[model samples]
Target chain A: MKGISHFLAGVAAATFVPGVVESAAQGSYLIVLGGFFGLLPDTLDFKFARYFEHHINIDPDPANLDPQIIANAVAVEIDRAAETQRAVRVQLHNIPLGPNRWRQYRIRFDAERNEVVITIGPIVNAALAPLDESGQRVARAKTKAKIDYTYDGEMTADIWNGPSFAFVPKAHGVEVQFLPWHRAWSHSFTLAALLGLITGVLFGSLQAGLVAFLGMSAHVVEDQLGYLGSNLFWPITKGRSAGARLLHSGDAIPNFLAVWTALALILFNLDRFSAPVQNRDPLLTPWVYLGTTLIMPALILIGVYAWERRKDHVRREVAQQADIVAELKETEV
Target chain B: MLSVIPSIYLAAPDETSAFIVLPGQKWLLERRGYEAAILTGIGSLCGVIVLVLLSPFLTEVARTLRIILSPHFGWILATVTLFMLMSEWPKGGDRGPTNWARFRAAWSQLAAGLLTFFLSGLLGLILMYRSFAPVPVAFVNLLPAFIGLFAIPMVLTNLIMGTRVPLQHVGGSIDVSPALLLRGTFAGSLGGLFAAFFPVVTGGIGSFLAGHATAQRDERTFIISQGTSKLVYYAGGLLLFFLPGLQLARGGLASMVSTIYTPGTPQLYYTAVAALAVSGAVSFLLLIPYARFSVRFLARLDYRTVNLGTLIVIVALLLLTTGLSGLLIAIPATAIGLIPSFYGTRRMNCLGVLLLPITLNMAGVGPDIARLLGLA
Candidate 1:
């Protein structure tokens, strides 16, 4: 679900096709296309799409640094979207305190309470190291409609940039979509196929086209396994489909599994299929290698992750019942 | 050793020798300098064990991979080049007069990076063909250029900014876990071996790839992995020098060593591995005092004065080593190296000096390109 996982998955997908590995051994760059296309969807969304989005900007003022005002502004948008039925898109920008310094803050929409919680966090340097000069405080504002913002923790506006949210009116209430510009038309199967066709024609090789198509689709499929699926169908269906929720996108174990599994597959393919039988001697032997590198490690890590997630779920349930909105605590060195 | 994290930043070539220490050095020195020294000492002992154990297996894999990937070096190099160049984004220009102005300002960082790469590449090409440096000193010809590109700019920056070195605290213990260590070693080795084996792929690139493969978000993991990566990349690259079948030169030291000696034997290779393990432990032992000494000594000195003295020594050495001609090369290289800091671009682009020329040669078009530019 991480960018690297998607990219590596694409490269691994290319190795599956016959002749691709051998061609790589023969000095062909067709394999690079796999990684390029694999990372393309996310690249499109983050690098280009996010910049072009039309959103109501909530540019915080470092001079005043008011949390109550910011909280009410967010509540008004969620309420307006619920009552008006027109999706309201908002972008919260970080407040710059000085050169390479920012006034950090947090904004979380509590669904159960129908309130937007705002917390003024510490002023942090470029490295997200709090300057120790500023103190933190909290504020809250009520909304008329049910707050449908979904996230496990508060969105911290620090260092690089801030987060965005789209309050779209659903049957239940206004659903808050984080980074509304992401995973839309860019993650489409339709676009992948079209691009594959064009690439094939341009390269005069069907294999290149297939690799391109498979690489991008691999990303879409991987995302489907996470909490938030991409807009796979894209033009055919306007919104993302519900994901399997097998894992969180930011979870470390699943990401490591994906990366290591891809590496194993690549090494195996490189040794097994890259050359003739007489010359080739495989380093990554069949089942034995897979059992050791892929199977055993993956089994142990996944079991641990499952255990941890269950514990986290129980803690979350307790926290939710208490009606306490949790904020990400800063660590002191 | 080359790396982006766990110390060893680009444009600050000083990190290469102490890449493992540099990344965490600031924090460690500021808080618990003594603990870092002790742990790294033990880490060296562990490194020796890891290297000795991995030697036999790594040698065989290296031999085979070389045979398979030798011809494909061009594309592999190109892939790394493309990935690095494309991955960079706008660091500034969030506010400007017009849309186009902001767009251009944002793109300036990328442009600066590209300009640095191409310019360094041009410098590499010029140095490769021209006899600016005397033939007697030709073996160490690029020394001045390297110092200019990687080392001098950092010193200059420190001198210009009137930087200060703060007093360090020496703590007794460091808090860490076995799992963290294992993860760091695993990730570091993967990256180091990848860089060590690849013809032109630097350790920085290898570590970058490995970092992505591991998906490590934790700061401690980053520090530990890069520490391991330096050991593997530097030692592994050198190990290739004595490999029975695959005696290829890489990195500055190995390439220089290759000029005087040629090694090819299984027994000798094993001996080198043993020596590496032993020397690694010894060096780590020496590191504690040296690191402690630096903290103590630097605290009393002015950063500007130190940087100024280093600049003088570097220039004097360059002049003495290759005469005035090396200075000729260093001038342009230093100017080119300064681009990254001034324009807020990537220092890794400075690697283009070696990467471009080498990639072009492997692709069999270096001559053609040089001819076009009248350098051939």
Candidate 2:
């Protein structure tokens, strides 16, 4: 679900508060609070948690290892992969602080042997000079550093424990991982419950706290619908559970339906609360309400779903044809 | 009101250019040098003249429309707007770079147009319609809405996506042939005239129609014509507000002005026209330096930081003006806004937000729909 869908779901929940409670002091505000709470789960993961998580760093001693050698070795491997028609790529970054010291030099290798280099300042440390036996400094020169390339075909390269590299296959390519804390405690159901409890205690209203819990839980559950599942139970669940792969975050129809449904419900609630006079002679009869609010939106959603499935079927057919053609070409080669 | 000024940056590419002037058009403009600029200027002047000439007739038509449509027209229009949005929904998935993909991409523009229209209406009704709420908040929430939907998203995408648009140098003496200038001006002005006359028709649509009508083969000519069309849509639209006979309120700025003061005199109309002319000239002069400065600034600064700052500013402004409710509205608006870019559809679908509601009102179904939903 998109961000707005989550927020709307929260708003829709608030609209469902009993009419009597809504008339009570700060009732409307509390209901609105539910909507805000609905956004809390994703908000925690995207706005706060993502930043706290760190990427794994692969730092090599600049004094002994020239980054150029690594760059060349990676380039060689990329070329080899390309020659064999295997997809691979490499990304290089070099940031210089001074003549001899560099802020950072990072290289990223992808499944397809494509190389992308980002450089800040200069590549080599010009200030570093080797001393001769007579205490005279030798001139700065370019030197190649040797890197071991021999490894099993497996993508994972855990050469050392301190700077372990894990290559995980992704939709686009293999993601070279340096850090492990993704979809952890922050995306946990336990945390959401705790937060809800804390909020309830502070606000002196169990209902308010429940709204908070519902909001957070809604987000966690929605995320579980995607391929990347959340750590539902946090400490008890050590790893993310495999998700029910029905849709992606980017899928348009599901997101649209969620938002539309939420909006429709919210509007219905708003009409009920705001127009007491109209309620006596309501413009929308029960039948009309059933047709417009529920039936129409549902029909549109169903239509979109069917259309998408047909499109997907067509896409799969094309992909299979392309695969067959590629196999034939490889055999010819 | 102050926040409206920043909206120009958002409006420039989307509302002003209307996505008619493609990359190819831009490249042609750059390649053509001074000729393109001169032609653009002439074309804009022509557009202004056409708009000025057409104001009285269009205003009368608009007045008649309001009277005839009155009460139920808003609903009917709103419904039509929604249908337009639905019709434009992108159908195909990621099919690589096939012709079908391109066709889907082109058709998806309607989706954006619909979404934007819908969002604007939703926000307006919630914030401005006093009849529906116990405590009606009369504050104009459009600025914040636009900020969240268009401005913030644009800046954030630039930052997070790390996609840098290379800015080409636009400098040198301009030299346009008189024939080219005349042709471009006529075509552009005609487009502007049509846009001014029609409700819900933007400059982009007008220019696009004109481009086809005139069979404009040259990209440079198309770019120059679009430039003129934008000026007419904005400046000429403002000028129309002051026309004594017309009393027209065409664009946002003009609509705002009309709320404060009614136009009834030729003297005031002339004054407004003069102001527009002076402002237009000053803006033209400022544009070159601003463009150059922006290019350098973008190149030197980290786009991520720039975008982050922009996002913070928008949030602060939203909080200051519309407060919590406005922020809440922004959350949904942003998500809807992202749909176009995310799905690789046209951003125009977002316009359906306003169009759907407004059209529904005109059709007399809006109130019933509202009643059914308990919002009436």
Candidate 3:
């Protein structure tokens, strides 16, 4: 789930807390606490934790431009994780070639061949549009350990500081993880409750504490629907628990559904509790309005998304195929 | 009283919004501008239809929302401002001579983005506390500043880089499926409605929230959704102001119109709906030819010249409306606007101008800040 989804989920959750919405309608800022906490988990990871994580940095030299070196470097990390029964986090630095120019590369784990596949791709401009078709080659290095990675998509080290990964030693093999720093201690129910307790103590309002707990809990639960589940109990849980695997974290339909459903819930609560009964016509029956507006649309969109996803070869390589900078500029938010 | 065109115009790529521009620019470059623009227009039509169909029910929703959100607007605005600032990660800066260099380089871009936002926000604060544009032209006072912040930098960049608009293909038909359009419509409407309903939330932010929540990745779906969201936000926001008993004034159109007239009738509300549908059709009808004309024009002229002409026209207009004082405001704004491009930051940070000052005001600290800055 994205930031806005969690934010809205927190807001919707706040609406359900007794007296929150009524006070909100009457000029109280207590409910805003829900959104702040709801988004707090991700905010912590991306803003603070991302920097603090001790990563084995792999910065490729533009002058050298060798794929084999990169492949072997990654293979060593995987082997180390498995042999030592420890987790290893690796950060791949992109090769820069002057102003708005970069030598791009792709790294994908091959579970079938038991190799790390590395492809040094074309020299791309600011938009990740290839400057020329030249300067491209592929290299594969055999890994000592059989990798057990769930992610099928290739992590392209083009722009955006590339993607980060962690290799965890599992009983079966070395498990590969994308964005290893994310969804760790921050996205935890334990942390949520602790923060909630702090808020309650500070504000001396049980309502405030509940809003924080539930708002953060909503983010964790929503994330469970995605490919990667959050560490619900934080330090109590050794590693990230596997998700329900229902949808990709970046999938459009589920994100939309989450936002829409949350919104409908918010609206229903607002209309029901905020408006005076004497001045208002009866708000639509909750089930009827929700069924017509939210549930029906959710079903249709889900069906469409699922059907389209049948050809899901990593979103059919849309991001890779399209110009990266072009896409980023258009969707600046 | 129930005009939708104001919202529609407001929705156009401008200070607060204009999510359609970059996608539209890409399509125009690909020669599919015709189809893309047409599809977006259609997407907006769907948005209008949704707005009109839901007009009756929305009346109650609007009234209830105003009551619920009136008190909490301050922190809500503050949260959005905070999110907008915090989310942007370093685009690049992995390289430099040393660790400190690398750290500085990366943080530099981040700092530039933050600085851009804060600087623009300072400008916003100045404008809010003191006015140089005069009272009669108050409605258009922000126009010059907007043109400076958003428009001038791009024109200058194009001129400096010698960037050209690629020759476009005037394709006859758009490659769109009913399913895709429906998805776009659904996502876009969600965004537009969010923007229209929420105070201080613009169509761009709405589209962004909707896009993120919906995870629209496909190029076409993203474009169509943005188009729809913009229309729904602008027009839908205006429509709310005319909702008879509800009459919750929102958006620029509603704000401006409220000064002169007040609307309180079902007939007026319904008339606005009818007008929306009709005008939306007319806008779409013109989009096809307009896109085609643009393709032809770009094919002939040097894009540099086009940008040059644009700068001249913009500066001329600024001078005419705001006198020399507007140009003074523009100079600093243009400089602040360019920070994102030079520092490898998100241009969206430029929105800090409006978001920062407004958030301060809503939070009841605007006057204090103004006094602290000696603007008061």
* Candidate No. with top TM-score: 1
Better of 1 and 3 by DockQ: 3
Better of 2 and 3 by lDDT: 3
- Rank the candidate models, highest TM-score first: 1, 3, 2
- Range of the 10 consecutive residues with the lowest summed lDDT in candidate 3 chain A: A316-325
Looking at candidate 3 chain B, the ten consecutive residues that score lowest on lDDT are B9-18
Residue lDDT tens for model 1, B31-110? 44444444544443454567788888866777766765665677668767766665565554444445456457666766
Q: For residues A1-333, write the lDDT of model 3, one tens digit per residue.
A: 667778888988988999887776565677778788878887776555666677788888888888999999999999999889889998888877876577889998998888999999898764445777797999999998998865566778765576677898888899876666677898899999999999989999999999999999998998877655778897999666767667766666677778778878877777676665224543557798889978898898788878977876543123221222222322233
Task: Summing lDDT over every window of 10 consecutive residues in candidate 1 chain B, give the lowest-scoring window.
Answer: B9-18
- If both were scored by TM-score, which would come out higher, candidate 1 or candidate 2? 1
lDDT of 2 by residue, A93-160 (tens): 23333423333333333223333221211232221111122211111211121212212122211111
Q: Given candidate 3, what's the lDDT at residue A276?
A: 59
TM-score of chain A of 2: 0.55
Q: How high is the TM-score of chain B in model 2?
A: 0.69
What's the ranking of the predictions by lDDT, best on top? Answer: 3, 1, 2
Give the alpha carbon lDDT tens digit for every residue of B1-376 in model 3.
1122212211122211112234554444344555666667777888888887887778786766665555557766776666667556555455555556666766787889899999988988888778767777766766766877888987787677666445566676788777678778888888788788877788778776555544445667766787788889999989989988776677998998988999998889989999998988887777767667755765787766767898899899898888888888898889988876576666777787788888888766789999999999
Query: Per-model i-RMS in Å?
Result: 7.0, 20.8, 5.9
